[model samples]
Target: MSSSTLFSPLTFGDFKIPHRVVMAPMTRSRSAQPGNVPTESMATYYAQRAGAAFIVSEATQITPQGQGYSFTPGIYSAEQVAGWRGVTDAVHAAGGRMVLQLWHVGRMSHPVFQQGQAPVAPSALAPNAQVWIVDEHGQGGMVDCPVPRALTVSEIRAIVNDYYTAAANALAAGFDGVEIHAANGYLIDSFLRSGSNLRTDAYGGSIEKRLRFLDEVTDAVVDAVGAARVGVRLSPHITQRGMHCPDMIVTTLKAARRLSDKGIAYLHFAEADWDDAPPVPESFRRDVRRAFGGAIGVAGGYTEARAQAVIRAGWADWVAFGRPFIANPDLPARLRNHLPLTVPDTHTLFGGDERGYTDYPNAG
Candidate 1:
C-alpha cells in the first residue's frame, strides 16, 4: 500500500499538521508521586515525539474520585494543572499539536485509589477488571476491582461538572483540544454498556437511557470548549472487561449520530488489538461514516501500510499508533522512510523511569 495518504498534511479542527499520524494515548503511569503530577521528563518524552500529527496525552483523571490506576496524572488540581503545562508547552515548542484525554475509571477502580471507599459507577456490579495501585512502600501491583456504588442522579450531574472543569483545565494547561475518555470499559463506557449499567433511573435500562450520561458529558464538554475542539473516543467492538453488548454495533452507530448531531470535531474508535480480537467490519465503518460526517480515527494493531489503505479507502480519516511510538519517538519519519522500527520493552511500559520511557533513540 502507498504511504502517500498517511504522510500527507491534514487539518483537524483549527489545528493543521504535517501528516495524518496521531499518537494514541498510552498510559505509562510515570507521573510524579503524591500528587499524580506530570513531570519535566514527561515533557521531554512528548517533545521527542513531536513528529506525530497530534498527540493525545495518556488518560488524566478529572478528579480524585475519577482515578483508578497508580501514577496516572490528574487535571483537577492547581499543582497538577501546572505539571501538565510543562508537557503541553514542550509539545507546542516542538511544533506539535496535542490534546489531553479526560478520564474517569468508574468500576474499574480499586478502593485503595478512592479513599478507601467503593468506586462509583452506573451500577453496583463489578467489571471483574484489575487496577494498578501503589502501596506506602512505593511498590506497585494489580488488585481486583471491587464492586462499585451506583451514582445517584445528583452524583452523575456532579461528575459531568467535573468533566467540564477538566476541559477548562486542559485549555488552561495549553492543550489544543481535549478528548473525552468514553471508551475502554471506563466510566462512560460502563454507562453505555448494559453489562455494567443496570440502573433503572433515567440513566439506564433502554439504549436511550444508557446513552444519557454520554450525551450530558458531551454537551457539557462541547459547551465548555467549542464543538470543534472536543473529541470523543469509543470502542464499539472491544469486548474487554465485560464491555461487550449484543447491540454494541447498533448502539455505537446511534452514539455516532448523536455525537455528529452535536457537531463534535472527531470520533475516535479504540479498536481491539488482541491477537484474536474481532476485526472491525467494513459494513460498520460505512455505517459510521454515513452516521457521522466528521473525521474518524481508528487505533489498534495497525501497521503503516494497513493504516494508509484504510485512510485511502475512506474507512478512517486518520490512524493512531500507540506502542509503536513508545519505541520510535520519530515514528512518522521512520514510517515515511520505510525505516526499520524497534520493539518496545514491555517491562517498562507501565510505572517506569526513563529506561523505556525517554531513552528510545531515533532511527539511525
Candidate 2:
C-alpha cells in the first residue's frame, strides 16, 4: 500500500506540520490524584512520542463539575495548570506541537465524582452509561451513570463561560492551541443529539436548537482563544450510550457548516473503531469537505494503508493514531521506513506510572 501521502506536509491553522500523522488523545489515567492534576510522568509520556506532527492531549476537565473519571487531568486550578505546563514544555522541548482538549462529562459523570450531587446535563435523563472511577480505597472500576439534573438557562451560560476559561488556561499552560471535546457521548455531544436532549427550551427540540449549546460553547472558546488556534472534535456515527439520534449525520453536517463559518482551525472526526463498529459513509466525508474550509483530521482503527488512502483521496488532511502511538513512540519514523509495530499491553493501559507508558522503545 502507498504510504507516501502520510508524510506530506500540511498547514493546520497557524501551525505548519511537517507530516500528516497526528497523535490522537487517549486517556491513560496516570495523572496525580488528590487534585486530578497532570504529573511529570505524563510529560515524559508525551515527550517520548514527539515524532507525531501534532499531539492532542487527553481530555482535560474544565472544572471540578466537568470531571467524570478519576485521575484524569484538569486545567481549572492553579496546580493543575502548573502540572500541565510541564507536559506542554516537555512536548515542545521535543519539537512537537500540541493542543489541549477541553472536556465536560455532563451526565456521563456519577455522583461519586460530584460530591454527592447528581451530574448536570442539558436534560434530566439517564444515559445508562458507565464511567471509570477510583474510590477512596484506590480501587478503580466502571460504575453505571446516574440520572442527571437538567441545567437551567443560567447554568448553561455559566458552563459556556467555563469553556472560555479553560481555553485561556490551556494557552497559559503553553499549549499551541485547544480542541473542544464535543464527541463520544460527552456533554456537548449529548446536547447535540435528540435521544439525550429532550428539553423544550431554546437549546432543545429542533436540530438547530440541539446544536445551540455547541454553537455557544464554540463561540465562547474561539472568542477566548483566536479561531485560528481553536479546533473541534465531533463523532457523527458513534452511538455510544445516550448519544444515538436518528439525524446524527444530517445534524453533524449542518453543525460543520456553522463551525466553518467561525473559521476554526480544523475538524477532528472521531470515527467508530471497534471490531463491529459501523462505517462512516463516504457521502458524509464529501459533504464535510464541502462544508468546512479548514483541515480535517480523522481517528479510529486506521492502518497505515487506510490512512494513506484517505489522505490520497482528499477526504482527510491528517490521520490520528491512538493505541499505535502508545507502544511505538517513533510511529511516524517506523511508518516512514515501513517497520513493524509493537502492540501495547492492555493491562498497563491505564492508572500506571511508567511501565507501559514511557518505557516503549523506538524502532531499532
Kindly list the per-residue Cα lDDT of model 2 for residues 212-283, writing each as its tens digit: 999999999999999999999999898878687999988989999999999999999999999888777888
C-alpha lDDT (0 to 100) for residue 252 of candidate 2: 89
Candidate 2: residue pairs that collide: none
Error of 1 at 70 (Å): 0.5
What residue runs in model 2 are displaced by over 4 Å at the alpha carbon?
Answer: 1-4
- The local distance difference test score of model 2 is 0.92
Give the TM-score (vs. native) of candidate 2: 0.98
lDDT of each: 0.91, 0.92
Q: Once superposed on the true structure, which residue ranges of model 1 sit more than 4 Å away at CA?
A: 1-4
- 195-288 per-residue lDDT for model 1 (tens digits): 8888988999999999999999999998888889988999988877988688878789999999999988899999988888778889999999
* Top model number, lDDT: 2
- Give me the displacement of residue 233 in model 2, in angstroms: 0.4
